[model samples]
Target: MIRPQWEWALDDVEGRRLSTPVTPVFTAQYDAEQWLGEHWRELAAAGAAQASLLHDGKQAAPGVELRFP
Candidate 1:
């Protein structure tokens, strides 16, 4: 059986994909979400303007805004 691939697609203010600060790939969606919850602040500070949850190279949910006050 093929396990689902979970990852985050991070974008910049201009909506361009980022190459640095590589995102982690997961076997479960829950683990991917938890990783985001813990590192969102750093991601935002790293110039990530938005984040989208992806499963097997396809969008799995609505994108998240990374702007923090």
Candidate 2:
């Protein structure tokens, strides 16, 4: 099952939420990294989708997850 993209915090006064896609294209276990990195600049320039890097306080990868507006 696809994970939820949004989570709510108890302290959110206006019910502000934290959201991010739990499954991105790069989550595919193929050559996703190479394809995503190579085309990301053009994709972003074309306003296709929003791309952001993922990190866990240490390492970063070339994988990208796209979110739509």
TM-score of each: 0.93, 0.30
Q: Using TM-score as the measure, which candidate wins?
A: 1
lDDT (10s digit) by residue, model 2, range 6-41 = 211111123232242222433442344455555654
Give the whole-model CA lDDT for all candidates, comma-separated. 0.94, 0.36
User: Residue 28 CA error for candidate 2 (Å)?
Assistant: 5.5
**Scored by Cα lDDT, where does model 1 land?**
0.94
Model 2 lDDT vs. the true structure? Answer: 0.36
Instruction: Provide the lowest-lDDT 10-residue window in model 1.
Output: 13-22
TM-score of 2: 0.30
